[model samples]
Target chain A: MSSFVLFTLTGLGLAGLYFLLASGLSLIFGLMSVLNLAHGAFFAAGGYTAWFVMDALDSVPIGLRFIVALLAAGLVGASAGAVIERVLVRRLYGQHVEQILLTIGLGMAAVALMGGWFSYDPRLLTQPDWFGDTTEIAGANVPNNRLLILGVAILFFIGLMTFLKRTRHGLIIRAGVENPSMVRALGIDVSRSFTIVFALGGLLAGVGGALGTVYFNGISPSLGTTQLIFAFIVVVIGGLGSIPGTALASVLVALTQIYVNNYLTSGLGSISVVVLLAGVLLVRPQGLLGKAAP
Target chain B: MKRSSIFLFVVAAGLAVLPFVPIEVPLLFSGPFDTPGTLQVLSVALVLAGLAMSYDMIFGYTGLLSFGHALPFALGVYGTNLLMLEASIPYVLAAAITLGGVIVVSLVLGSVALRTSGVAFAMVTLAFAEAFSILVISDPLRFLGGEEGISLASEQVPDMFRRVVNTRNIYWLALAFTVFTFVVARVVVSSRAGRVFEAIRENEPRVEMMGLAPFPYKLASFTISSGLAALGGTVYLLAVRGANIGTTSADFTLSILVMVVLGGAGKLWGAAIGGFIYGILNLRLSTVATSNAIDNLPEWLSGPLSEPLFVLGVLFVILVMYAPGGLSSLATKPSFGRATRRS
Candidate 1:
């Protein structure tokens, strides 16, 4: 029972990162149709940014330093996302396929640049003392950081839900996903919302990266990329553009991975996740929450 | 056209006779042109050139953007290497078996992945490739080789292709493969099925309206292209002398896309040249990165420049945004920057 509880909680922690990255990716692909291959790069940048900021905050209290680092990472991600959209992605505006190619190039370059600045070697980040402690829950010693991640993810999910439901920009984004031209016909300029959606995604991924660095105990140049593949799986398994679907699928995929990896052989977990993806595709090609193809 | 064919023949002839030449090019080669070092680099170039052209069949001609092209290539290298080293199969038989395996594997994966169209198709294929990659890297079964892939057994390799001195023979095989792929791609592109592929790319609904099932044609393109990539994989193992985890990576698939797009997607020769140059540049740039000229520059400017992927990646982005037609179009014609997707 202790092991099961530990596994479930830890699994939920991992799901937090996937949710952050996949939610952003789904929103971008939903409204813009750009896969944003560079989304991983943004995640990496956030990791690096938080790492650097916290590393330099020798004067600050450990707890306070982490809060500052996390916010900085999110800020850096948002700025970069907005800039990429305004400068590079906006130029190829209606050419969604071309946008994919462009993002691929950007992703490659950004990751390479990160690798160059920081060596391929993994760098362990500085975390607070309490974060290193374990919290006993139901006789299971759960890492405090794992609980922190789960808490953050839940808060972000509620925040995302609220923003999407309450805001006018959210309405425009949702409508854009249904039909861009129809939204435009109603005299709404989704062009501005495009940048907002991109930034919003970057903010979530960036924040996730910071927490990922904390969860994994270190950050490497390739960290974002390895995680990105799983995030893509979650996004596809959940319906693209559906926030609630993304949230639900993240938990399912993460739990399955953790449970299998713990109970079964080491590698079967990854293979099974893929098998799960294939099974889903075979049964419902449009995805579980996605509507039929237009 | 006649003049261009003659020019092509001249270039092909020059490349074939390169092994016998004793002369050296200064910075690019560490030794004479025919030496093993130069030949290995040239051989890799030829192998990738062939691989790029094969990718073009599905991506450029059939207009399917597959992120899992690396799967067949990785299988080709890993399968042959696994058979020879672990199972003790001879090189000749192993390669033949692997090629057969590639055909079946690609066919099955293609049919399932092709069920979804466009971006969904790309993601599903990627998931499959990533799964295979994890299998190879993690080594669920010990024969797959965890993390570090296996090396070739000298005894299993035939007498003609062993040791560093025999690099020339491998180079010749790569050349043969490239020429074979070029011919096959050209022949198929001009054939009836090829027309259907282009039509499907132009407009899938229209192609369906024309009483042709696009599924079979798309599947055919996927199989043929992956078969050639697998064949190149066998040759790649011979040239590089081992199968590591890098070839199976999604990044490797992206590089293939870069090569095809950089050269000119629809044009076979464009992909060949683009991949060939990319190989040389990829190898040479590593050498250049450590040079005094690069190291002397300010860290701010030189850091990103030192990474080879940064250069090629930026080049890819610039090309996509400004010149969608690629290098071939500069000579043949210009295309307004638009990624090839059905209207």
Candidate 2:
């Protein structure tokens, strides 16, 4: 019973991070039709920013530190996204390969620059005093950080769903994804919409990264590559341009990963995940909730 | 003035004489003294070049962006290692087994990965490769030798020729492989079937409308490309003196698609040149930079970006900004950069 609860909590916590990372990638692809490989870099950057902020303000209260770090990461993500969208991504719209290459390049540069700024050794964000302490929940010993992650994930899903469904910008985003050419033709300034989407996506990715530092206990230069691969896998499994699908798939993948890790040998566990993914593709080429091709 | 014949003659002469030159200075233009070390380097280069060339068979010819081409490479290397260590098989038999193994694996994996196109295909392949890497790296009965990796005794080359393999002979072996691959790839590309591959690249729907099943073509290419990639892995193992689970095969960047793009995907020569440049940059240039002192640069700038991820970024940037069609365009002196006005 304890093992089951532990596995479930772990899965949920990881799913939150996955949703944070993959949501941005999915939204970007939906709006731009381009795969931005560097989305993972934003996640890494956010984590680093958070870590830096906390270190610089070493004496601050843990609650204020968390808030300040989260805000810093979000702002950095948004500013970087806006600048990148205007200067680079705008020219490479519709060119999927170029976009992948460019983002991958940017990701690499970010990692290298990070290594230069912060040594190769990994850095971790400290958990708040309230969250650092462990708790026994439903007969299972759970880390407060894990609980925080789950709460954040749930909150993010609710907030994102609400924003997309109830807001004017959200409606514009939906319309853009459905018929981008039409949206542009209608003089809705689709470029402006794209910039906003990119920034929002980056913000989410940043927050995910910041949160991830608490879960993983650290972030490294190479972490971006690993996270990038994981995020890409989640995006593929969930179906592009579908937030609901991303959320569900994130949980599914996390659950499967945790279950496999616990139940099977590590080698077989990985193979099983791949096999499961392959099975999914063979059954549903467009993903579980993906729109059927015309 | 037979241009083709002259080109062949020049290539043959360069390969034949390149090893006799002094060992201290790497030949700028292929003369004597291209020792066993150089030959080993060349062999590894040819192997990678062959893999890249075959990758072009799918990626370049079919317009499929598969980030998972490394799957076949892993299958080939690990399969050959198993054959070599478990069966105590000779190199000749082991090579054939590895090739066959990769073909089967590719067909099975491709059936699943090839179901989708564009980004979906790329994602699925990448996922599979990741999974495969994890499987090999994870400790399971030490079959993949786990983290320690498996080592081979030696190749089954004739005893007399073994001496020739020092550095120069290895270069010859590499050259022979490169030449053989170049010839085979060119012949395949020039065939009627090659035209079908090209058509698939241009428009799959149009080709299907003409009553051709694209799956078979893709499967065939996947198998053939995989077979060649396995052969590349085999050569790489021999050159490196052993195989490790995490080194190249498990590293997410094993089957470098960017190099293929940088070199020119469809062109065999492009693959060769791409591998050659990569080798030089990785082995010679990195070594020099690491060893030599840089004037007035910060200490951080001087460190080796030995991590594959670091170089990949730079390579991606160069490929994206400068040569979309690859380095083959540079070789052909094509007017590429002139057209993109970047509004």
Candidate 3:
């Protein structure tokens, strides 16, 4: 019973990271109709940036450095997103193939540049001392970091839901997702809103990447491609443009992966998630929480 | 003869005689037929051209943006390797068997993937490819050889595939396959089925409303393309004498996509040209970076310049942005000219 509880907690903790990555991708896809293939690059960049910050700020307290690293990652990702949106993505609005090719090119460029600069070596980020300790939860010992990640993920979920329901900007994004032409006809700056949403997505991805490095123990240039594939699975399983769907799908995928990993080989765990994704795609093409296509 | 036919003959003749002609270019480049090294690069390019042409059939002609095309290609490579190395099958027999296997696999994949259209199709295919890749690398069956993959040398297999002695023979074989791919692709694009494919690409719903089943057409195109890609993979394995996990990676798929798009989608000749250019650049860029010329460059500038993929990425973006029609358009009239004339 304790083992089951432990597995569930671990699954939830993993789901938190998936949620952050997939939500951004889902949000961006919903609002802009642009599939940002370079989304993983931003995630990797965030993690790399955080690593750089932590390394450079070795004299500072670990907790303080961690906070700074997360912020820096978000900011850097946002800036990159803004520039890419303004310069390249702005032109290829309705051309899906062109957008895919362009974004893929950008992704390859980003990864190659990162590889050139960082030398393709994996870098580890140090977690705070407190994060290294474990605590008893319902008679099962749980890592402090996992609990912390779960807590943060819940807060993000609530905050995001509230923002979408209550805030003006969030409302505009939702409206755009539902009907961009209608929103534009009503004189809302849909394009500007798209830019903001893209940046926000990048910001979330960055935070996820940075936090992931601390949790997973290392960051590498290939992380962009790896994370991108995961993000794709999450978004596809969750349903495109559906936040709640993404959240639900992430948890499902994470849990499936955890149980599979525990019972089978680690490699089989990866394959199982992909199989799950395929099953979802075959059964519910629109995703679990997504609306049917018109 | 018609202008197009004459032009085709001339191009085919040039390619046929290229390996025999010992032409050499200056420092910036070398002819494909000039040296052994360049010939090897050109051979790889020809195989890639075949792959690119196959990709063009589905993506360029049929309008399906599949991300799992590498699956068939990888299957062909592994299939050929297994038959030749383990079963001691002849090269021709192994290739035929592998091609058949790839078609069956592709049909199965197409049935699942064709259920979804547009972006969903792409994602589903990608998922399948990723699953296949993981399974191969995981080596659950113990036949896949895992990350190190399998090698096909004379010691391991037959004498025909010996790298040193059969370099020229492999080069010619790759060329033959490339030409065959291009001709077949051209024939398909001009055939009745190709018309249906174009119609599907232009508007699937309208085709369905017109009482034509788009699914069968799409599946047929996918199957044909997969077969051709499998052939390309067989040739690639023959030339390189090896098959690895990277052959089935997303990166390989991206490279094929880049080649097809860069050459100009829907144009078989353009895809072939694009593959050749991409292959040459990929090989030559690394050589250039490590050559004596780069040694004179400043340290800071030299570091990033040494990576070929960086340059390829930049080129891909620039080409997509400025010239969507790719090098094929440049060979003809400007795209803007065509647009203005159409209007």
Candidate 4:
């Protein structure tokens, strides 16, 4: 029973990481048809930036250092996202396939550059002593990192929801999603909103990456890619553009993976998640929460 | 024959007779063209060209951007290896059996995956392939070697493929396979079903409106492409004499997509060209990475220049941006490629 509690919390932590990626992927795809294959690269950028900052700040206070690292990662990722959009994606506007291909190339190139710079070796991110400790919940000793990551993700989720509901840019993004041409017909430039979405997506993925280092225990060149696969499954099963759907699916996938691995065979967890995806896709092609395709 | 076909035949003939020629190319090769080292590289390149052509059948022509295509190819590799080692079967019989398995799996997966369209289809296929990759790496039964993978038993291989010394025979086999696939793809691309595939790619709803079922055609393309990929995998296993988990990766499928696009999609020969160039570059670029010229560069610049994948990835980006028409498009006009002209 205690093990089950640990598993659930760990699963929630994993779900938080997935949400960070899926939210961005879902929104970007919802507004623009682009799949953003380079999203994992954005995540990696955040992770590496966090790792770098954390390592370089040995003289700084430990608690504040990680905070600074996390913020730097988000900022770097946001900038990178905005730049990639303006340079590569903006040129291929409306050419969905070409845009996707361009991102693929960019993704490949960026990951390889990271590998070249840092190699594939896993690097441990330094955290405060509290991160390593655990808190008891109902007789279960749950790791503090898990709770921390989950808390951070939840905060981000609420913040994102608020932004989406309250801000003018968010309103523009939502309206643009429904009908880009209609929004254009209303004399509002949707292109600026595209840049904002990219930046927002980058920020989420970046923060996720830093938090993911805590979740996964280390950072590697291929780290983003391995997690990206599960995130893709989450996005697809959650339905393309729905934030709430992405959040729900992330929880479903992470919990299923954790429980199945503990109760059943170990590696079957990932396979079962894929199985879940296949089942969902077969039943509802648009996904559980996604609207039916026009 | 048409001028291009005649030229292609002459080139094929020259390649066929290349084994007997002891001539050397200056910059491209470290040894004579027919040497085992060179033949080995050429064989892999030729096999990739063939593989790329096979991928074109579905992705380029039929408009299916499947991310699980590696599964069929990986099946051919592991199935043949396991059959040869565990069952004590000969290579040919094992290969044939694997081909049968590939057909069945592709048919089953295709029917299900084809149910969705656009990005959904890509995800479904990717999911299936990832499952396969996971299963292979997991190895519950312990037959499939985990990450390092399994190799074929030496005694089980045919005489002509027994050792590195027999690389010439394998190279010849690769050349023959490439030609066979190219010819098959050419014939199929111009056939009635092929016309239907292009039509589906252009506009599926319109094709459906014409009272024809798109599912069957898509499935047919899927199966055929799978069969070709499986054959390439068999050739690959023979070349490297082993199968590993990397072959089952989504990265492999993406590379195939890159090859198809880099050459010019919907153009069969263009895909082969793309595949061959990428294969050669992939194998040979490591030499460039370690070369003196690149070593002389600044540390920041030289570091990335040392990685072959980095160079290839950047090249992929530049080409996508500037030369979206691909290598073939830069050479000659695809006069009849009206169906492929969209961005």
Candidate 5:
């Protein structure tokens, strides 16, 4: 029972990272109708940036360093995303194939740059002293870092939901997702909205990557490709442009992956998740929470 | 002869004589190709051309953006290798079996993948490919040989594919296979079903409203495309004398896509041209990067720049941004003729 609880917590912690990664992808797809394949590059950039910051600020307080690293990651990711959107994504509106090719090319460039800059060796992010400690929860010994990640994920989920539901900008984004032409007709400047959404998505991915680096104890240039595939699966399974759907789908995928890895072989875990993605896509093309296209 | 047939004949004639042609590169442009290297690169290019044309069949003609194309191609390679090496099957029978397996796998994958359209379809195919790759690398059956992959000796294959004994045989085989693939692709694109594929691409709903079932046509195109891709893989294995995990990787799939797009999608000849350009560029660029040609640069700057894939990535981005229509468009533009007509 304790092991079960422990596994479940581990699954939820992983699900939190997936949620952060997929939410941005889902949001961008919903608002801009652009499947930003380079979103994984943003995640990778965030991880690498966080690692650099942590190394540079080694003399600072551990907690302070952690916060600074995360913020830096988010900022760097957002700026990269903004640049990509302004320069490339803006011109390829409604051209899915072009967008896909462009983003994929950009992604390859980003990964290559990372490899060139950082070398191929994986780097470890130093965890804070408090984060390193373990905590007892419901008779199960759990790592405090896992609990912290879970807390952060929940907060992010609530914050994103509130932002989307309550803020005018969020309302505009939702409106744009539903009907871009209608929003444009109302003088919302859909292009600007797209840029903002893209930045925000990048920020989320960055934060997720930073957190993931600490959790996984390492970061590498190849992280982007692996995480990108997972994000794709999550977004597809959850539904294309649905935030709530993404959250649900992330939990489902993460839990399944964790359970399979723990109980079965690690290789089977990846296979199972892929199978799950195929099954979900076949059964519900629109995804669990996504609305059908008109 | 008809114009198209004449064009085909010219292409075949050029390919037939290409291996015998002595390529002389100036000192400034000298990198990898001497003579044998050029032939080897040309043979690989021919195989890739076939692969790229197959990709064009689905993505360009059928309007299906499948990300798991490498699956069928790799399956063909591994299937042929396994049948010949392990099962001790004859070359013809093994190839036939591999083709059969490819068709069955394509039918199964296409059925599930075609349930979704657009982005969902791409993801679903990717998922299946990832699963297949993982399984192959994991090698639970032990036949896959894990990361070591599988290699076949000259004795394992038929007389024609014995690269060790006679390298030119494999080269000719690849060239023949490439031409065959192009002809088949050309026929399909000009056939009645090909018209339906284009119609579906332009507007699926309208075609559906017209009482034409797009699903069957798509499946047929996908199956045919997979078969061709498998054939390319067979040629690749025979020429290279091996199959590895990289054959089924996402990178390989993306590379095939890049070749198709760079040649201009929906054009069979364009894909072939694009494949040749990409293959040649990749080989030459990598050779240049590693050579002492850029030794003047600082270590930090030269280290990354020396990698061919990085250069390719930058080129890919630039090409997509500036010339999304690919190299084929440049050749077919008729800009000079248009200017003269305007004058």
Candidate 6:
């Protein structure tokens, strides 16, 4: 029973990381109608940025460094997203094949560049000394870092929900998701909204990648491909453009994966989640949370 | 009697006669006309060309992009592998069983996924691919062989094929299959069904209004395309001597779509050319890397500046931006007449 509880908590923590990675992908996909294969590259770049910051400022307070690293990831990812959108993706509007090809190219280029620069060695992200310590809760010991990550993920969700509901830009972005053409007809600066949405999505993915680095204990160049697959599965399972649906689906996927990993096939745990996704997609067609109509 | 048939004869005759001379002596001449390895590579190219032809049915002709086609290809490879290894079946029988399995699986996936359109359809296919890849790599150990992948025993090839199924035999089989598939595809694309697929690509609503179900035809096309792709994978395993998780199945990057575009998407001959180009580039790049020639470049670029990703990426971007019709457009000029524009 205690083992089950521990597994559930671990699953929830992993779900938080998945949420961070997938929500951005969902948001961008909703607004732009573009499958940014390089979204995973942004996630990987975030982890690398955090690694660089942590390694360089050894004397800085560990907690402050972690926060700084998170911010830096968001900033870097947002900037890159903006540049990519303006320079390349802007020209690819309405051409699905072009968008796919370009983003896939960018993703490969990023992987090759990172592999060359990082030399294929995986890097582990360390938590501050305070968070590195373990604590006991409900007769099960959990690491402080994981608890912190969970809290951050929840905070991000609430914050994003509020922003989407209350802010003008957020509403416009939502509107864009519904009908990009309509947004343009209304004389809203749809391009700026696209840029902002792309950056925001990148920022979320970056932070998720950073947190994932801390949880997973290592980051590698091939991390993008692995994470990209996960994000695609999440989006498909959750239904594209549905944020709440994505959140629920992410948790479900994470839980299935965690439990399966521990109890079933071990190394093959993620396979169950993928199978689940396929099953769900088969039944729902549009996705679990997909809109009723196209 | 027909102009096109005469043109085809002339072209075929020229190609068949070209190998008599050394490749360096003429523009069309290629190296070692009689070598087994060359024949083997040509066979592989033919198989890939067949795959590209099928893939282009959806991507180029029908304007539907599918990411899950790789799943059928992988299944085809593993299906044959499993039959030979566990069931102790003959290679010919195994290939047929695998081909049937490929078509059935395609039907199942297409039935559900074809319901969606555009990005949704693409995403669904991707999901299936991920699911299938994971199943093969992880659990379902009975069928997938896990990550290690199932190997072929030397005794599996039939007695009739044993002596002949060497590099040359395999090459001949691949060439025959490619030619057969190309001709069939040419017929299909020029037929009523092909006209429907093209119509759907141009305007789905108009085609639907014209009394075509659209769904059935799309599903049928998807199934046929998938079956051929699986055949390609099966041949690959036989020729390469075995199937691994990565090697047998097409990677997402080089998904047969890349071959489709490289060859000239809508044209069958272009697809074959695309396959040959892909094969030549891939083989030669690896050779170049291991060769001493890479030593002269800068330290950063010295190590294999000829990565397929770089070539593919550049080609993809350029083709999408400029020649959306693909490379075959440059050669065929189907839409343009000789005296109209070019001097």
Question: All candidates' TM-scores?
Answer: 0.97, 0.91, 0.95, 0.98, 0.94, 0.89
Stretches of candidate 3 off by over 4 Å are B26-34, B153-158, B292-300, B334-343
How should the candidates be ordered by TM-score, best one leading?
Answer: 4, 1, 3, 5, 2, 6
Task: List, in order, the clash count of every candidate structure.
Answer: 0, 17, 0, 0, 0, 0
What is the lDDT for B327 in model 5? 75
TM-score of chain A of 1: 0.98
lDDT score of residue B300 within candidate 5: 70
Write one digit per residue (lDDT tens) for candidate 5, span A189-218: 888878888898989999888988977888
Write one digit per residue (lDDT tens) for candidate 2, span B1-343.
4686478668767766766656555333232345565566565665666677767777766667777777777666667767877878877688788887777778888888888887888888788788777766785776777667777546553343345356455556556665666666667767887788878877788899999998888777767777776776766666666676643342334336666766776666676666666655554444444443542357566442533445656775767767766777766766423113121
Q: Which lDDT tens digits does candidate 2 get at residues A55-171?
A: 888798879889899889878877777778878888777666677767767776677667756767988667677777778878888878888888988888898889889998888
Which candidate order results from sorting by lDDT in descending order? Answer: 1, 4, 3, 5, 6, 2
lDDT of 6 by residue, B1-343 (tens): 6786577557555544433433441222234655555555666666777778877777667767787777777777778878888888988789899999888889988888888877667767776777767777765547667778777654787653344335666765666566666667777778999889877777788988998899988987888788877887777776666677874332542446677776776667777677767765655554555455765777577532545555565566677666656677776665631111111
lDDT by residue (tens digit), candidate 1, B223-281: 99999999999989999888989998888888898888888888889899889988988
Over 4 Å off in model 4, which ranges? B334-343
The chain B TM-scores of all candidates, as shown, are: 0.95, 0.85, 0.92, 0.95, 0.92, 0.86
Interface RMSD of each: 1.3, 3.9, 2.8, 1.4, 5.0, 5.3
Candidate order (DockQ):
1, 4, 3, 2, 5, 6
User: Which ten residues in a row are the worst by lDDT in model 4 chain A?
Assistant: A220-229
Candidate 2, DockQ to 2 decimals? Answer: 0.52
Question: CA lDDT, every prediction?
Answer: 0.88, 0.73, 0.83, 0.87, 0.83, 0.74
Select the stronger candidate by DockQ from 1 and 3: 1
Off by over 4 Å in 6: A59-61, A119-121, A126-133, B1-33, B139-145, B159-165, B247-250, B289-298, B301-306, B332-343
What TM-score does candidate 5 reach? Answer: 0.94
Index of the highest-DockQ prediction: 1
- For model 4, name the residue pairs that clash: none
